[model samples]
Target: MTRALYSLCGADERHFFSPHCWKAVMALAHKGLDFEEVPTTYSRIVDIGGGFSKTVPVLDDNGRLISDSFDIALYLEDTYPDRPSLFGGEGGKALSRLVEGYSQMMIHPAIMRIALLDIHSILDEGDKAYFRASRESRLGKPLEDFAAGREAEREAFAAKLEPMRHMLRFQPFIGGESPLFADYIVFGALQWLRIAAGLAMLAPDDPVMAWFERCLDLHESRGRTVTAA
Candidate 1:
């Protein structure tokens, strides 16, 4: 029973850095499932899933292909009912969705601004060109221009995390007592920031940072396998 997760990477195949892909990776670990990671570059996405999707984190679960991070989480939960639950129940699923929405809508954009140029720099030559062209077209600006003033953007990015900060003040995780998929959602965001930009998004004294440290320590310290930047 070989499970392969097609993960997005930079110049070095070991550097798996996509936020959505991180979600899948953590979800798999949360379920106590073992998987082989197939490193896929930005230019290689079309070659995966028979061109069905244009993203990484495509899970080849014993010939059953699943794409999209959220969908993959649901699949794992249903398929491995005996394992640890990613979402505790129906209400948990809904709450996870809300957390996912907030991370994608609010956190990702900010991290992108700060990490865009760094991400470009770490890519292989082919991926660098492809990333630049595609991102420039979508953003309607050069990558450098889009990533300008990144240092100044950090304060605003920190301000956006107040909700997570407030929540962490009360509980160790967004999922309450222990980490749930909701915790992984925000973990993916910060993990992306850490890997791509090598910058600290939260203060060392912050509760959110403490929560992230705990998350990194989960499942045999899986997230720590990939070093920052």
Candidate 2:
């Protein structure tokens, strides 16, 4: 049987709001695939059923372990070639690459900062301590020192928004008329800003925001299903 395992907490609002996971889920739904979700704690992720890295969105397809969200998305596209194309055609593929690259380069860092803002609330005290200690060990600087750079980070993020806004204004979706991998990539980054920072990528009048609303509508219509073992 073809089986997939997703490691995620059942009650995490942030994980539910995660665009990365959402995109993967959407792809699975789009392909009409049957999969299982494995509810996991943060620490147990690295060693759930043997020695493995603790990543929440890990996909184990009949014992072949695949980690990382982007990799998982690509795997799905390759595994189920008969499904609707996520990359669209050559122009769409090119657009997807540009959108993914821009999102990773310009948007992800800011989203990371927004997530870290309330990290203490989400993680246990022990986990928080361990996270800080690990960072300190690697960087030789305190977490507080690293966190103090938030203002500059936000400003840098804001500066990049203009160019993104310009690019998105012309197209209904990042990859053109229809949704594609590029749309999902950018949506994942934007989802972080919306949920983590309570921010919007564009003004209310912007066409990009309208596209986002349309994406959300499509997401809601697809439905989410969770099964028990």
Candidate 3:
């Protein structure tokens, strides 16, 4: 039986980057796992999840169900120890935790607001309509109103980047030599924000930008492929 990885289709266009999905996909790519990608909408997640919380990046390995991106990464690391190390080592593990915490607690929400502001320009009319309708149906407010209220909060988030920039060295990757789970997590969260807000161009000389490029180069060299699913 083949393993299956479920993700939101058109996530990139939707101005949504499921970090969980990215973690799983990166892990699978690193491990050379032969898994099938299953695409579904956010609505479908609730309908098919049997009353569980609706979330993308759910995985089915044979008959076992695994949810959450970090859990999936850990599961894969344990299941395939011979593959490249995502946590790197003790230092990598600690850094991973720090990166994950920052991404979850600080970066994601702010980036989301920025993305919401530019959603129309990034996505086509149908996708924009679908997303707006979905949000209204789920949250009972217009996307524009929501984004407007959160603009200040999002602007504050850019300050958090200062520490990240200071922490980064002239190394090619986050962990100094190779790209780790932290790199991918940070990349996934910030990359979409950068693209949607055009903030990356503002930091052309920053180490974080160089690190980001290195991450892409490393993944490409490893034949990491991302499809629509």
Candidate 4:
């Protein structure tokens, strides 16, 4: 019953850049769970878990398969109650739901714009082709086209994080003294940008940036395992 995480990766398997996957990775580490990461490329996603999902961060714990990052976190929380809690309790779980929504709606689009071309650049040929076709179809534009003017998008992205910055000024993390799944939700998006584009979206002096540094230091610096870009 070896546990394994089917993580999304680029041409370099070490470059696991999926924001959702990073959530699962951090959740696993937060629970003190050890598992093998099965680097999965875009072309291979359909072959995983009997094609149970079309996305990565598919956790295979023993024989139980779970897809979706939030679902994985919930599964980890439930199955490993004795381990460090990812959500802490029902209150934290509800808070994490809000955090997940904020990360997806406010943060994910900004990151996608900034890292679109960079993400394409890191993929293998087949994956690159697949990525380009799928993204272009959805975006109705080429990656380069969509990623253009990203420098301007950065300011807007930073502005959107003001709520988090305000909160961080009062506490070390969104989880008050320590990080919970709430903090990891935002960390995943920033980690995605860092890994795919080597871009730092935050100002060095900002409290949000400071919080990110602390997150990178978690689980014995697990987030730093894959260096930026």
Among these predicted structures, which one has the highest lDDT?
1
- Candidate 3 — which pairs collide? none
Which of candidates 1 and 4 reaches a greater lDDT?
A: 1
The C-alpha lDDT values of all candidates are 0.90, 0.62, 0.66, 0.89
Candidate 1, residues 174-211, lDDT tens digits: the string is: 88899999999999999999998765756788777788
List model 3 lDDT by residue over 130-176, tens digit each. 77887767757777777775657665765766656776745566656
CA shift of 171, model 2, Å: 1.9
Report the CA-based lDDT of candidate 3 relative to the real structure.
Answer: 0.66
Q: How much lDDT does candidate 1 score?
A: 0.90
**TM-score for all models, in order of appearance:** 0.97, 0.76, 0.75, 0.97
The number of clashing residue pairs in model 1 is 0
- Which regions of candidate 2 are displaced past 4 Å? 5-19, 54-56, 90-95, 136-140, 200-202, 221-229
Tell me the lDDT of model 4 at 128.
Answer: 90
lDDT of 4 by residue, 117-168 (tens): 9889989999999989999999999889999979998767789888898897
Query: Model 3, residue 32: displacement in angstroms?
Result: 2.8
The residue-level lDDT of candidate 1 at 58 comes to 95
lDDT of 2 by residue, 14-112 (tens): 234445665666666556777865555455566754755556577778888777677776787888888877776667656666677788877876666
- Candidate 3 versus truth, CA RMSD in Å, comes to 4.3
Worst lDDT run of 10 residues, candidate 1, spans: 198-207
lDDT of model 2 at residue 137?
81
Per model, how many backbone clashes are there?
0, 3, 0, 0
